[model samples]
Target: MADYLSVSALTQYLKRKFDVDPYLGKVFLTGEISNFRLRPNAHQYFSLKDDNAKINAIMFKSSFQKLKFQPETGMKVLVTGRVSLYERTGEYQIYVDRMEPDGVGQLFEAYEQLKRKLADEGLFSRPKRPLPRFPKRIAVVTSPSGAVIRDIITTVRRRFPIAQIVLFPALVQGQEAAQDITRQIKRANQIGSFDTLIIGRGGGSIEDLWPFNEESVARAIAESQLPVISSVGHETDTTIADLVADVRAATPTAAAELAVPVLSDVLAEILKEQNRLYLATSNLVKNRQNQLNRIRQSYVFQQPQRLYEAYLQRLDTASRHLNQVMTTGVTDLEQRLQLVRQRLLAESPTRLTHDDQARVSRDTDFLNRAIQQSLQTKRQRMERAVQSLDQLSPLKIMGRGFTYTTADDEVMTSIKQLHPGTKIDLHFADGLATATVETVKPHEEE
Candidate 1:
């Protein structure tokens, strides 16, 4: 220790060594995360650790923005960055430029993370609104210079040239791209009378297509008042925005195709319906004509008098049958009248008048005797029951011998309720008397 090195001096030397050394400047590292803290300002401070050692690591807001999944403690990560020294704290750390989930593509990892989050929050489970079958105006959010917009325009023009297309220019990748895309989506909604929104971009690597996976962009799509169709990359590439959007398309062209129906196809269908109507009318007219021809060729139309001839023959046959039926009916009526007269003579009242009269007289006498006997019996029984009831009646019993005494509206059966000076009523057979209760003498049964 010939000369003690200052902290700044040592850090500066270390920084210089990190800057020049090929291995230190750029490195691809794999390790487990520890002591990870996500900053409020969108930066990450953490330590990367292995079995024997650990090193400080930092992910700035810009680099962290590219990550698909949030880094947490005990997570394995693969990071590509440079090793550098923090002169202030005299600590050497790795400044991560790019990061990916271990053993998984960053885009897929991000998709899973966003899917889980949105599913938990019910954004993905929310009822999706149906897109308008015939849109008045379709607003497209994509790169202004990319083939995605061109493909959409060409497809829409070929299918439905009548519908209007409005383009909202946005960056599909790079820094702040997600925010720009979200801003354009909102701005397009405010500035236009667009019935539908198509957000899309051309296919690319996950790193080149990270913006569409941002949570802000996904939330923007979810909250949009206009129905949003997300067409990101090819059919294979799905972004978080796709999950929350009202509809998802395989490609930009597919999105435009979904937005409007083909005018030529509709015209063809109309033409087909018109042809069917014409054929049906022609067939109906032909059928009616054939029926008229058949009627004209028949004997009735050819001769004209043949219609009356048939009626004349039918009238003759009906008249003959009617005369025969009338003759038979008169013969049957004469026989029925003769039988009825015979029955009437056999049942005549004059034939048995004496016997009927004697029987009626005998029955009348018997009925009168029976009624008189029954009435006498009921009267005697009723009288005896009345006498018994009279004997049981309180008034009748009291009339014979007993009397009733009461005090304070209660029968004087006991002395418990009576006081010495209480006034009482004594009831005999026909009258009651007032008496003072001088002493309550409790009666004992003999």
Candidate 2:
């Protein structure tokens, strides 16, 4: 019993020793993970082991959040961390800082991880953009030595010789391939010459085709402003890059077909349109000719003089009818005038001038005698009537000792209408006497 130490003191000493040790400070270890469990809080706790040796490991929540894919038991992983002692548990373990998939280099896992993520984000939705129908310049991202580029070139040339093909000359496989493809895509965008991008490679195994499945490449395709067509691996082969791409073709030649339009087909379409135009023009001309022919065959158009001839004949007929009516009217008027003259002669007293004048003179002498006798008789009767009227005249009566007494130019016949002092005039045959009314008399007659 040289020196007995408490477990706490012992563990503390060991923890300090491990923490300060140079060999255990930082390490890179390759092992298969065991007893791995993801905590509900996202921390990872596992054991890294070989056939004979094992050590406890922990991935904190923050460091675990950085991993693109989930880890499982028995997964081969390369971990970099420092060996440290847990003071509380008095256990030795490795605190993992960084991790990568061992056999697959973590790229595949990252590819799958990104594919699931983008798929969840709807990047692989069917609403992908359509490729250009007539691309003028097509950019290709593939090895310049491969049959993929050759096939694309030949297909594009055969389909549309007018389309210019530019090669981006990128690596198609291995570690550097993904970065190369991404760089070239960016470079092509920077150059800004190509109208469309065709990213493709010859068909290969999954390992040989791993680069195209990279998340970086997928993201590059997704972020590209220009349209991209992805043709990688075999027809059945699918990749994360293909999912994020604008269009996915089965083959390199298919991608070329998608990029450009067929010149032959276009020419055929134009020729068809031209033929239609020619037919339309021909029909128009035919219709016009038919119209002209119909016009020429018309009666008025064929014999223009017939119109004037018919009008002149109508005018002549009208003139003859008018002349007949005038002649008949003149004859009837002449007969009427003669009959009227004869009737006037038969009924006229002035037709026998001597007899009429003698009769007129006798009648005039008789009228003058009758008029004189009438005048003489009228004068005698008038004298007698005047004598009788004179006998009845008021002046005559007044001459026979009659006078009229008037007050205010009224006869004072009534005593009731007279006043005793009223001024009056007395009318006599010789003169009128002005006097005051002194008296009035009333008489009662039976």
RMSD (Å) per prediction: 16.2, 21.9
Local error of candidate 2 at residue 184 (angstroms): 0.8
Q: Report the backbone clash tally of model 2.
A: 0
Task: Give per-model TM-scores.
Answer: 0.46, 0.42
lDDT of 2 by residue, 1-446 (tens): 55999889899899999999999999999987765645867778888776577789999998888888777655779999999999888889999999998763243455567778888877787477667788889889999999999999999999899999999999998889999999999988888877899999987545568898777787788777789999997676777778788888999989888888789998998999999999999999999999999988988887899869989999999999999999999999999999999999887777678788899999999999999999999999999999999999999999999998887778877678877778888899999999876776767778
The CA root-mean-square deviation of candidate 1, after full C-alpha superposition on the true structure, stands at: 16.2
- Model 1 residue runs over 4 Å out of place are 1-136, 158-163, 171-196, 204-228, 243-247, 260-300, 308-355, 360-446
* Lowest lDDT 10-residue stretch of candidate 1: 103-112
lDDT of 2: 0.85
